[model samples]
Target: MTARTDGGAAAEPSSGTGRSSSVRRTGRWQGVAAVALLAVAIGVLAKRPPLLLVGAVAGAYTAYPRLTATSDPDLSVRREIDPASPADGERVSVRTTITNEGDAPIADVRIVDGVPAMLSVSDGSPRCATSLLPGGEATISYELRARPGRHVFQPVTALCRDASGSVEVETSIAAASAFECEAAVPDVPLRAPSGHHPGPLVTDEGGEGLEFHSVEEYQRGDPASRIDWRRYARTGELTSMTFRTERLAEVVVCVDARPESYRAADATEPHAVALAADAAGRIGDALFDANHRVGLAGFGRRVCVLPTRGGRDHAGRFHRRLATDPAFGLNPPEPARAAEREGGGAPPRSVTGDGRNGDGADADGTVSIDAQLSRIRAEIGADTQVVLISPLCDDEASRIAQRFESGGTAVTVVSPDVTTAETAGGRLARLERSHRLSGLRNAGVPVVDWTPDQPLGAAMTAIGGRSR
Candidate 1:
């Protein structure tokens, strides 16, 4: 795996030049003035010239802090992560350089590079402390154990102090950097598929297949090998053996990227949406490898639907869309109005059941979850199955799974277990999640209860075993 350093389409840097309005007193010399006054009083009463000299020195020290004023330091930051694209559990090295752009020397410069919350520093430090003269730079180096997802860097935080250390200024520098790790999924965990095109899935319909379906009266153009020769000899009748029909399946991998799905058991770990996206990518790739038509969708702030298709190019498009689409973004979707107010991209248009243009939004322009489900239902065909990836943190996720299954579409749910027992609320949520998964299973929906602690393959194996 190689990391791409080009500031191209993949690297989406944060907006904003830099923010440095904060300035405050450090109070390093808070009591020095009082000490100076005490020394001066003692010198005047005791009538000692050496004491007076000492007092003068103390007074100068007291004034020294006030002599240098603290202002926001002009600085620039450059960051780079090597082995940008890493394999699962690979360690990536990051280096950041903070340069002082101001003419004056900064006596104390402290920098903290913005590391993605999902990644943890495994080696070295993301922090650096040094004095930077004009045009000087300091580097902060660190190693991160890469996880699956598109992890983006936040703004770099810098703190500058004056020579006396009495005043400090803090600022944030924007730098856009990110990397993605794609999980290797050997096969898509799917139940028996019902599809149209000829492929691996066997259907009840008799056609060309390996599995026996039935035997019927022999007709013209019947293949000689298919004839029931033994039965024909015994009964003076000819019959042709028919086998089950095999067909390729179209699968839509839907990711639950709603705000509710962003929950994580640990703050430092990747959220459920990220995990879902990662799993969805792997599932899509596996389906494509099997010659099955694959599509992508996101039930986020707006309904996103990429109609089912097949090809090597389509696979690449699917992976790129999962990584870059706002619906599957690492951050929760901003409210539609808020996004408009902030001049961000407008919310995507709601899609109809036919995957065409439709207004599924309310007056506030927020697409309802029901509308999103309706759109997905429209995409489902007789031979198409839906693989729903969600955290299952709430009843809505269960509702989605049940809805798809009730519609007569083969549905398999891959739920990332993000619930923890660290708190009372977390414990309750965990219980609720357990109940929800159980309910889904009872409802005849295949549920893969996936915990981040185990590899996705293990969870798929559990699902595969249950599917049998």
Candidate 2:
């Protein structure tokens, strides 16, 4: 019923007592002895043969514990999980094997595999019980479903028992099984500013800048400070001065975080959505640092938008939204809220009617296909450049990218290839993905083909920032 500390006894050397680790009495011995004594007393009073036989068995069973030595059994445990780095919702098979390495025979051994907390046993159990002799090995196999993030499988719980149920020795076994589920997002690629929305690019035809552009005929209301007074004194003609325009690009970094995007090539790899999300944050950070106004828009079962702004604080806010925006995170919308987001009468979880506000349909859940495109257009205004980060798993991404470009908004597609050619279906899927990207390129959308494992900058550098 309760565990008592062994104090000095636990620390004592095993050689003197012919025992190993300190053991605990399971307390079942006391209950068995009481029952045995009662049966024997009843048998003696009634002189019944059946009762006497039952009492004899009970008494022998009671003696079994006393006959066995209370010592820790010598055992070694090893655990292995196939496909260690499982993607979200993927299943991984795990096997835990324990060996009786010592000469003593273990009557009963229970071994429990340490499954990660973020993972659930989808197919088999985490524990198994068995008996083993010297050199005998018992293996337990199970399957677990993975989620996002890294999870370390805790140490295995091993319990050893002797012939008698009185003594128990407990220990833990750790075989270094760590399962990391999320995809790696190391760097993001960005197109240097050209002619966009106004950050740092100096335009030729400009006015009101620090650097001198050119002198022009002075108008009646020209500012005296801007007038070329030296030229006027030399040639006696009043002329105004002009300077280059620092035009910054209005940029919208779009990330695809749909449930479909949360897929990995197999159980032992990261998912596409994780990669996309990481890239989105990095790109947003870079653009913000470059003094370009950057906004974030997430497309999934729900749409999330954070208005465009240029500052370190806005970068932090973008990172936070990427971390906690429920539309793109593990937690789905609550029921009432989900209803409001999805209901027609309620607002769509799409971009707000006024995209510049950056408060898109205010957590509107998933919208219809047309509504999605409409929201995307609304989120990106005219002359704004859009960088879409996706895995290109579906053709719809290609179509959307092209649609934006055709609508006078320059669209750049940065797709991280997540498909593998391991199987026929995977090969076909990869080919289809290539075709879709090719179609986008043909449609004049600059496609930045990238692999998730590689540095994003390398891929962009290969293209030398040329999107069209």
Candidate 3:
């Protein structure tokens, strides 16, 4: 059978090709009545026993369907998904078994298992048409490609019909399983720091390296090669040469998964929330490679936070959180208060605590800006530099940047410009977004206004080439 992807469960099923041939009130009873009456009249007038019998049969056939029509169908369905939480672009198999619990035999049975709207079925079909007797069962299996996000399977739609095709029972039942794709955390390339910490990054600082930084009085345990032999010979004093320091910094990749930030000029294109995730992962990977301790945080369904740490294991933990975590895998923003009124909506709230500050986030993902800032200030370390990925539509990013700078922590605003100036409203929105970026720069926070047309690495490189 050809597998199909439905946009989602429909309020009414007759809208698509999976249409049912429901019973119609076309007055077929009138035709049956006319035939029965004609036969009865002929039998009485002509005194024919054959005509009388024919009339009786006609009457019984017409009434039998209505009498046997089933108003209530007794049935149960159980669904299962293998590898319920699959990675992005992975395929998953779904199976559903429906059992007939009624006493009578159902001649025609049609079932449609609710599928995730974001997934596309690659093999088999969720729908099946079959007949089942009392205690009999039927099963359906299908395969679907997994997308990045949490998906809630809808209820099952079942239609049962009697043998005469005259009676049918239609009802929906809850499914046994749900599918989810967690946040896919990735590595990101972050700026290096100067410290005597164990890391792969080679920076311009006085520590251990080949490049000379400065010379100081020789200390114990100094390698002979590090000693400035010419200076020692000339001055008859032991002196050591300091080289660049290879160190790691506490880097946090902050993603603005806010519903308002997830938009695009074209509906067909992926939203900015998705882009931010991609950048976060790749950048985190690069930073980790350089031995930088990478962390992750975001504002979506809730505040998601991971502390700064460095290791291969830590990288895997970050990816798992980004891919499967509800805070990162939520759907795009709906047309709600969260999108329209973001300042009062969810801000940069930390995820570790009670969603603290008493400004609880709404179910749709909006939090108070002050509460978010307070949470950030408390949750993150003082030495950590925040790499913020957002659309910069609201003043939230600017405010956060200002606060971080005031606290002596460097902040970079990498905004994915998703606005189009094709219309008056579009032009106005673009102007406002640019203004927000300008304000951040004025506040000493370097901003990278990135457009979606180019790769994220290029935009980041542009920001990196400048002195901070």
Give the TM-score of each candidate.
0.69, 0.49, 0.54
Could you tell me the lDDT of residue 44 within candidate 2? 88
Q: Give per-residue CA lDDT, model 2, range 243-318, as digits (tens).
A: 8656776778888766556655753344576667756766676677667778888877667777677788888888
lDDT, model 2 = 0.65
* lDDT of candidates 1 onward, in order: 0.75, 0.65, 0.66
Error of 3 at 290 (Å): 2.8
Worst 10 residues of 3 by lDDT: 347-356
Alpha carbon deviation, residue 394, candidate 1 (Å): 0.6
Best of the candidates, lDDT: 1
Task: Write model 3 residue lDDT over 1-468, tens digit each, in one string.
Answer: 111222222211121122212343323355776798899999999999999999998998788677766645566665667776788767788877777777877788888776653355678877788988887989898987776555556556676666666655555555434666653433233445423565665566687866678999999999998899999889999999898776667888888876567666653344677667766776677777767788888865467788888899999998888765555643554463245336522211111112222344455345655565566657778778888888886776676667777877778778888788887887888999989988887876777777755555666677666221
In candidate 1, which residue pairs clash? Answer: 3-84, 13-176, 197-248
Query: lDDT at 374 for candidate 2?
Result: 70
Question: What residue runs in model 3 are displaced by over 4 Å at the alpha carbon?
Answer: 1-189, 192-196, 214-224, 230-240, 336-367, 466-468
Task: Output the better candidate (1/3) by lDDT.
Answer: 1
Residue-wise C-alpha lDDT for candidate 1, range 1-468, written one tens digit per residue: 011122433344534453433576768786877888888888899987787888788889888987887655888766777887988789988888777777888999877777775676789977778999888989898998886666777667677789898887766666667888776663566666566678865666787899888999899999999999999989989999999877787889999987778787764566788788878877787788888888898986666788788999999889888876666766544453254335422222111111212345523676788987898778756767889999998999898888888888888899989999999999999999999999999988888888876677778887675221
Clashes of each: 3, 11, 23
